[model samples]
Target: MNVIKRATAPTPKFFKLLRNIGLSIAAAGGALMTAPAGLPHGLVTFANYLIVAGTILSAVSQITTLNDE
Candidate 1:
């Protein structure tokens, strides 16, 4: 019963999407960081936020994937 229960559980597709989105976001943030100075002040803040968010999402995805297996 325990084996059957585990086998019947649905794998989360959302986590894969989250991981991809996170990679894109982090890449965008990195690209933004490479721009020349004199850019808008908020850009850096936004970029930093994206980087952090991406990192978190990627980490969550990896952790969940590992546990799921």
Candidate 2:
């Protein structure tokens, strides 16, 4: 017996690009946060904010990308 796989729906390329960019930003933010030397209070706060925002954007983009049904 043979079975074939098929996609019931498809995602647009732009959504995939947006998702990848958001994830890359998240990686950059994480690297900044875990620096060997601690960052100043204000800069630390800003970096933390970027991490959070980037994570949220990544989640949203992934959801959009996977919303095909």
Q: What is the C-alpha lDDT of each candidate?
A: 0.74, 0.68
Q: lDDT winner among the candidates?
A: 1
Candidate 1 — what's its lDDT? 0.74
Clashing pairs in 1: none
Q: List candidate 1 stretches off by more than 4 Å.
A: 1-12, 66-69
Quote the positional error of residue 8 for candidate 1 in Å. Answer: 21
Q: Model 1: which ten-residue window has the lowest total lDDT?
A: 60-69
Tens-digit lDDT track of model 1 for 1-69: 354453445436887788788889998998888888766879988998888998888766644532443
Model 2 lowest lDDT segment of ten: 1-10
Clashes of 2: 0
Per-residue error for 7 in candidate 1, Å, reads 20
Candidate 1, residue 58: Cα displacement in angstroms equals: 0.8
